[model samples]
Every structure is written in C-alpha cells, then in structure tokens.
Target: MRRTRRDPIVTTVLTLLVGALLAGGWWALRSDPAAPAPAPAQAPPAAQREVTAQHSRQADRPVPRTFDRSAHSTTDPSSTWVIVNKSHPITPSQFRPELSIVRGYQVADPAAGPLTRLLDASDRQGLGFKIASAFRSYGYQDSVHKQLVAAQGEAAADRISARPGHSEHQTGLAVDIVTPADGRCDFEPCFAGTPGGRWLAGNAWRFGFVIRYTPENEERTGYSAEPWHLRYVGPALARELRETGAGSLEEYFGVPGGDYPPVP
Candidate 1:
C-alpha cells in the first residue's frame, strides 16, 4: 500500500463522489414528513361555474318535436297564426291597452281588415259573434300580466294571460269572438252554452278564421279550452284547419305554437 501513489485527478474524483453520496443520504434523512402537499387544482371561477350549471340544466330539458309559432307567427313567416279569446273582450285595444288611441281602440293590421269584415258579417247572421280582442302591444301585455297576477295569483293568471312578448296580440292576426246567449245560431251545442263563443267556433273558418285553441288540444296551447279565440290564416289555410278538426294551430300545423313545448 505504501508503494502505490494515486493520481491527483483520480483522488479528487473519488473524494467528490463520496461527498455527494453522503450529502444526499443526509438530506434524505433530514427531510420532513410534515411538509404540506400542493393545493389541489383550483376550480373554475364562480361565473364560469354558473354558466356551466345553466348549460347543464338546458341540456336536461326536453326538446319539442314540433314548433309553436303562436307568439312568433305574426312576425315569423315560417309560423302559422291563430286566435286567442274571442268574446271575453272586444277590440284589439282591450288586449293591448297601451297602443290604444284616445277613443280606446287599437289599429288593426291591413290584412286583418278583411277578416274583421267577415267576422262582422258572420255576427249579423245571428252567429252571436263579435270581435273580442285583437292586436296587443308589449306594454299592454305587461299591464295585463300585473292585473292577472293580482286577481288570480301568479300561477292561475299565467295560464290565461300571455306573457309579454309571448302574446298572439302582437301578431295582429288573432281575434276572440262572443259566445251566443241562446241557441239560434250556426254555432255548436257547446257554443250555445257560451252562445257567442259557440257561434264563432262552428263558423269562424268560413270567414278565414280558425279557433286557435280548443278543449281537445289543451296540451299544445298551454291554456284551457278557449272556444272564442280565432286566428286569421287567410281563407285557404282556414279552410284546411277547419276540415282537419285540428284543435290547435300547433296540431293543425304539426308544430308547437306557444311558450312551452308540447307535453311529452
């Protein structure tokens, strides 16, 4: 052993290697078990979380097989129009009071003029028919909503009154007629019960009007039976609707025609 001399370079390298190993061992031994773990990945911000939740809720909702154009029909070409209440109130202004003139009447669309004449003529025939209501503006609808909420509570009023921007009155194509007081008209037996209401239901189509709602089609209209409501679809379509006995414009057109989708 005394006879061998190690190279300085080799001696230095060996010393460095031993020192590194010792240091690493010491470091491992001294490591603390109590060190905190890294924080979990942060969740999305609150706004983003809310948006995600909204999307999830929408996805869970059922899709309508058909389109209900009642609200949009007057404006959307693809939609077919229908009537609302026929006899409960007359004049379009009653349904849309905000647009009423000083005389308390609302203007009718030019297209509705002919239909109105026809309705008037039908009334003279002892049909007990009258224009119950017509074009409604957004403001009138809001007022109606308030009145209905006050009178019937929110839930019940929701069934009868169209929500603002979701009313047929906006379209200028809808009209309600009077049900007869007696049985002398062409109206059905049901119409005699509400004589003016009945007369219009039986004969509205001849004048290019169709009962937009009916008892058989409650599922589509989102309202109870409304025999007096009529919608002017022009003579051609009116005839078709009448022949088909389709209770709702939704059913007649094979689409949904209101705020909600047809019941599943």
Candidate 2:
C-alpha cells in the first residue's frame, strides 16, 4: 500500500516538471531576437485599399477619346474651316456669302455676333478696334487689284494684294482692323507694334479670329505680314490652332500653299 501511494506522488511530480519545461521553452522561443514576428491580423487601412482598387480599375479602362479633327469640311469654300490660299481658291470667283453688318463693316452673317462680342470685350479693356475693310465682291476686288497694280506695279501689288479670285475677303470672313483713335495706325505694318496690335495678336483667338498674315507665317500664307488682317475661322478651330501652336491654316490642315498653282 505504501509503494502504491509513493508511485502516485512520483508520477504527479513528473507531470508538473514536464509542463514547466514546455512553458519555459515557449517563453525562450518568444524572447529569441532571430525569431520571425507573427503575421499581422489587421487588414490594410481603408483609404490605402480603396486607392489601390481605384488604380486597378483605371488601368482596366480604355483611353478616353481625343478632339475630333474631322468636325468640319476643310475643302468646302463656305466651310468655317475652309483653308483659302493661293493654292486653294474659292471654286466660283463670283460666289458671294450672306453678309451682315458688324461695327459698320460687312462680314459673314455667322461672324457678326462674334465680331460684336470681340469688339465689346476689347472696348471693356479700353482697346478699341475699328474694321477698315470687309467683304469685297469679286468685281470690287478686281478693281482694287487693278488700282494697286497701277500705283505700285504688278509685282509690288502682288506682295500686298491677293488676286481677285483667290482673296479671302470675297468669303466675307476676313476683316482689316485699324485703331483709328490709338494713333492713325491703319493698314500699315507699323500697326503691329502698337498697343492695339499687341492686344489683337494675343486676344483675337478668343473671338474666332486670327492674324492671317503674320511675319512668322508669311512664307506659308503667301503674303507679307499684315498684322491688321484678321480671318474668322470660328471659335473651336481658332482655339485648336492656338492650343496646338499651328502657325497657319496650311500647317494645321496639311494644305499646300506659299505659291499660286502653276497654270495648266
């Protein structure tokens, strides 16, 4: 009976010793500096997860569309984007556009409202622009060309004037501006150096107009720099030209210019 009691105590002691050893081993493992940290249980922050998902979704979507270049006909004489140069003459020399009066000058009917707005905006800025010339019929242009030839000789006249059939004025979309009050700066090239000229160069695009014969683009436009000459191509195209840095309609549309086409 004593032997059996002693054996039970021995067994209990052995069990306690084993449990202590196991517990001590676990502690030692946790204290070891080289031991790997347990994987974190908490998920990523909500904002971080959301941003990652957004980036993934954006990458899966197709690229957005770009500006439509074919929004208008570039070849049609009556088109707002028509690129008229020595090479691209209006088909019928006698073609006349519907006209409207804007600031005491005749311009295309489509152009009147924009012209008025342009003038008003400039006037608010205290830079008044007067329209000196607009909308020349083929017959009128013919007479002007003859007079210039008579006064300046044919070669000299060609430098400043477009042949009757090839003139943009015939389309009623071109205007010659002058600052009559800001020092008699009329049709002369010196007008470009004046305050009104500077304003027009920088702000005309906002009103659907461009200085058609610029010193930088004379080669492409087939005319000497005529800073006072403004051509109305509508706001959209004017904006595109300005944004894209296209110096002339010829460069924007890949149209050929710089010379009259050879006679057949």
- List all candidate RMSDs to the true structure: 19.9, 20.2
Evaluated against the true structure, the overall lDDT of model 1 is 0.56
Model 1 weakest lDDT span, ten residues long: 82-91
For model 1, residues 65-168, the per-residue Cα lDDT tens digits are 22222323433421334333221122343343223221133434433555657656765776655454676676878899999999999778877777665666
The residue-by-residue lDDT of candidate 2 on 154-244, one tens digit each, is 8788777888878999888898888778656678889898888999999999888998888898889788888899899877668778878
Off by over 4 Å in 2: 1-65
Candidate with best TM-score: 2
Error of 1 at 185 (Å): 14
- Output the lDDT of residue 63, model 2: 57
| Candidate number of the best lDDT | 2
Error of 1 at 19 (Å): 99
